[model samples]
Target: MSDDPLPFLDGPWRLSMGLRRLEPDDWLRVDDAHDAQMRLRDRLLAERRAEVAAALPGSEAGCAETLALLLEFLPERFPERWTRDGQVMVDRRNGRRVALDGEPPLVIAGRLVQEDLCLMRKGPDGYELSAAVLCFPSHWRLAEKLGRPMAGIHAPVPAFGERLGPTVDRFMAGLDADRPVWRVNWSITETDELFLPGDRAQRAFDPAEPVGSGLFLRLERQTLRRLPQSGDILFTIHTSVRPLGDAIVRPDHAAALAARIREMPERMSRYKGFHLMGMPLLAWLDRLAAAQVRVAAPG
Candidate 1:
C-alpha cells in the first residue's frame, strides 16, 4: 500500500546495520491510508487486546512518558494532517478523529498512530521490554516477548549473538532523548498478510510462480529513542508488505534485491525464511535480467 516501490532495496542485505540519527520532523511517516490503517489496528486491538497490548506493573513511568511524547510529537511531525487542538485529535490525512479526554495509553497510541510502541527499561541484565502495543507483527507473538530482555527476544535471529548483540547493547544504553536512530530489515514471504504470527501458517504461499505472483516483500522501518523522564528507550516498528512482482517496475530494484538475496549468508537466509524461497526468487530475477539484456540489444 506504500507508493515506495523499493522500500527495502537499500543495496546489499540490510540487517541490523545502520543506526542513523533521526530528526524530530522524521520521527513518524504518515504514508497513505493512515486512518484506515488506524481503524484496522483498533479492530485488532478490540479482538486481541490481551494478545497485542501489554504492560508491566513497574512499566507505568516509561509508558506514561511514551504516551506524552506521542501526544506532542504526532501533530508536530505532521502538522497539516495530524492536529491535536482543544479536546479533539484529528487525522485529516485519513479523515479520522478521536477525543483527548480519557483514552487509555495503548488505545490512544493504537488509534492515533500507525507504528507499534514498545517501552524498553534498563535493568541489571540490560534493556527489557516493559510494555508494547503491537498490531502488525511479522511472525512473532507479542505476549511471549513481554518483559524479556533484548537478547532473549532476538534469540531466534541467527548470528545476532555473535555478530550484533554487543553492538545493540551498547546502542540501547547510549541512546539519548535528543538523538533518535533507525534501521531497516527485509524479508521475502510467501504471503502478503501483514499480521502473520509465527504460530500460523502463511496462507499466501504459492507453489506455482512462487516468486512471480506469490512473493511479497516485508520491510520493517524500526526506530529507537530514549524517553526523557524514565530514561527508558522507546522502540517503534513500522511494517510494510507489498508484492515483489508488482514492485519490480524498474530493473534496478529487482537487481538490488536479487544481489542481496544471492549473497546473503546461509544462517541469515534461514533466519529470514529466505532459504525456502531463495531459488524461486533468484529464477524470477534471472528472467528479468535476461529480458533486460534483450531489450538493450541493438536492432
Candidate 2:
C-alpha cells in the first residue's frame, strides 16, 4: 500500500542471502522518516554510545576511510538533502550540521546518514567485524559482535553455520571494490522501535487474539562495498519499520505474505519469533486476504 516497494509481499520465505548488484549511487537511502530516525540516532549516540558503537584497536584507519567515503558519496548522491561546505556537511532534512571533527569518524558518518556503518577487515582467520556505529540493530548487540569473525558474529542466526557460513566468507573475501552488492531482510516485531539491541523473550499469543493491528514489518536494506583505501569491506544497514496492516492492503500481497509465513521452516519461525504469534497471525492475514478479494471483485 505504501509508495515504497514491499519485498516481503513477494516472497516464498526461504533462508538464503538473496544478494543483488548495487549501483554506487544507491548505497544510502533517505525517506520521509529520515528526520525522525536521525533524531533517534542522535539520542542513541548521546545516551548509549558504548552499546551502539565499537571499534577495535587497529580499526581506526578503516573507520576514517569509511567516513571519508560517506562524506564524498552523500552530497553527490542526494545533493538536495545534503550539502558540503569545507569540513562541515549540512543535512537539509533536520538542519543538522556535522563536522569532520569531534566524535570518531565512523560515528560522525553514522550521524550523517540513517544507515549504520560497519567495517569488516580480513584477519588471520577471515574477515572480522572491526568497527561499527550500529544504532538500529534489530536484536543484536554491537559490542558482542565487535572483533568477531563472520561465523562467530553470525553464530546466533539459525542454520547460518550449516547453510551460508562458507558461502558468505567466500563472497566477502571475493567482493570487488568497484562492484558493490546489496541484500534485504525482513522481520516481524511487536513494536516499531528502531534501537532494539536485546532479544525479546518468546511470548504466547491466544489463537483468538487479534495479531495484525499492532504488529510491524521491519526491513533492513543492507549494502556491502570494499573500501578502496582501507581494503576493508564497508557494510551499511538502513532499517525501516512500517505497520503490518499498511503493508498488506492488496489481496495478492496479503496472500503472498501468508504463503511465505506458512512455508517458513520451524526453526526459522522460532528464531524470528513467529512462534509467538502462532496461528492467529496467519488467520488474521487470511481474513484480510479474503476481504481484499471481495472488495476488489467486479460488481
Candidate 3:
C-alpha cells in the first residue's frame, strides 16, 4: 500500500494513458500463459493453506481461515492500499493474468518467472525497464516485498563484475561528465545463457554467418562470474552505465542507439575463447563510435 509508485515508474505521478493494442493470437497466447500461471499459483496457495491447517487441525488455522489471515494481514500491513475483495482481480487484456489497477503503487501479480530486479519510468517514448532481470528478483528485499519467500535459500556468490559487461563499462568510461545519461535496463536474453552456441537457437539476431547487426550480444570469455548451476545464465546489464544521454534525442537517434545495442549480441558471438569474454569491449567501442558518427553527421 505504498503511495509511492515512484520507485516503480520513476518521476512525477502520471498514468499510462496510452492503450497498447495486441493481436488476437497474441492475446490468446498471453491468456493461456496467464491462466496456467494462476492455476499453479492458486494450487500453491491451497497447499500452503492446507499445510498450516494440518499443523493446527482443529484450531483456528483452517484452510479458509489461513487464507483469511493472509488477506487480512496484507490489508493491515498495507492499510488503505491493500484492500480485500474481488475488486483486485487478474488482468485478462492480453490473455495474461497479471494484476491491474489504476491507483498509485500499481498492483502486479506475477510469480518469479525470471530473475533480476529493475525499475522503469514513463517517458515521452514509452515505458522501459530491464529486459534481463525483468523476469526475476534481483535482490531479496524485492522478493520479500512480492511475497516471494527465499528464506534459507542458499544463493551462490555472484561472479566477478556481474554488474555490466566490459563493453558497457567502456561506454561509461568514455562519457563526458556533462552528458545526461539515462540509467535504463535493456533486455538481452529470452531465457538466460549468453549464447546458444549454434545456429538452431531461438536468438534475437539474424542467423546469417558473420553475424549481422542486431540487438543480441554474446560473450565468449568468463565475462560472468558466480553463476548458479541450476538456473539459466541470467545476467545483469547493471544500472551504473548510462544508456541514454540528454541532448533531446530525436526519434532517429533513439532508434540508432537501440539498434547499436541490439547488434551487440551478433558482433560479440564472433569471438572465441578468451576473446569472447573481452569481446564486449568491442561492443562498447561500437556504441561510442556510432554516437560520434551521429554527432558529426550533417542534419
Clash pairs of candidate 2? Answer: none
Cα lDDT of model 2 by residue, 58-138, tens digit: 998899888888788888889888998788999876688978787888899988989998889999879999999999999
What lDDT does model 1 reach?
Answer: 0.76
- Model 2: residue 158 alpha-carbon error in angstroms: 1.5
* Candidate that would win on lDDT: 2
| Estimated TM-score for each candidate | 0.90, 0.94, 0.24
Report the number of backbone clashes for model 3.
19
The residue-by-residue lDDT of candidate 3 on 1-299, one tens digit each, is 11111121233311221112222121111212333444443453345422111111122122222233234444454343344436443222323332333321111222212112122212232222211222222222222222111111212212212332333334423433223232232222222332122322332332332212222322111011111221111122221111122211344434443344344344233321212322343344356547767887999
User: How high is the CA lDDT of each candidate model?
Assistant: 0.76, 0.85, 0.27
RMSD of each: 2.5, 2.0, 17.0
RMSD of 1: 2.5
Score residue 82 of candidate 3 by CA lDDT: 43
Model 3 score (lDDT): 0.27
**Cα lDDT, model 1, residue 199:** 52
The window of 10 residues in a row where model 3 has the poorest summed lDDT is: 218-227
